[model samples]
Target: MNGRLRELSREESLRRLASVGVGRIVFTHQALPAIRPVHHLVEDDGEVVIRSHDRTALLSALDTVVAYEADSVSGDDRIGWSVIVTGVARRADGADRYRHLADPWADGEPGYVIRIRPELVAGFGLPEDNGHAP
Candidate 1:
């Protein structure tokens, strides 16, 4: 058998992100770590759009670059791949323009849209590192 191992390329990274419509967005608040799972839409320019309610904690804490992780897993033996995106996040000011493009899974949230412009995208497959049988 060939012992070739394949690494995820840039194209593969974006494609996988598009395939998985959901991801957990991670940020910090007052020296505390926070993570929220959000449904997102991928743009042609490789930005991720996430809608949040008016009471969103994430929206209030975006001054610097934040790391966001989006991933999917499949296999009975628990072997899977995870894709991570690190970027700067900002709240969108143009409501009308974002409203036209943004959509929430459920209606009537009266939410604001957060934009994540990724600076780096990386992915890796799970090995038997964390107590999984090879």
Candidate 2:
């Protein structure tokens, strides 16, 4: 693949994150890194929301720092983009409306709506041999 990696600004990164349909939540479990795929939705205020079950390991990470990552790649060209958000996770109280935003991958309805307020946003794009930068 012939392409360049273009660094995206915080604002741009958030935009990219917002565009993606799903992402991964990264947290520490058993003193080791653990990652779980999650359906995510970027809020208008730039916060990331994800659904979770009570028994999931992510619930243990509430109020703690975690990293969320999402990316998209072009099937033909392999050009892609990615965004990583490091933030504090907290339960969104009364998540009646927010609950449907991030779908749960497990069985049964989601037990909680987890919100991550981005503290650090980083992103990059691979623009498939394009002459112009992303």
Measured over all alpha carbons after superposition, the RMSD of each candidate to the real structure, in angstroms, is 6.0, 3.9
lDDT of the candidates, in the order given: 0.66, 0.78
Structural similarity to truth (TM-score) of each candidate: 0.74, 0.83
State the TM-score for model 2.
Answer: 0.83
TM-score (C-alpha) between model 1 and the true structure: 0.74
lDDT tens readout by residue for model 1, 16-89: 67776677788886678888776777778888777666345676546567777766555554535566778888
Q: How close to the true structure is residue 8 of candidate 2, measured as C-alpha lDDT?
A: 79
Task: Give me the displacement of residue 113 in model 1, in angstroms.
Answer: 0.7
Q: How far is candidate 2 from the true structure (C-alpha RMSD, Å)?
A: 3.9
What overall lDDT, based on C-alpha atoms, would model 2 receive against the true structure? 0.78
lDDT score, candidate 1:
0.66
Q: Model 2, range 1-134, lDDT digits (tens) per residue?
A: 23468877898888778776788999887788888887888888999988876446877778889999987756665547778999999988755776556455655464678899999998887645222223
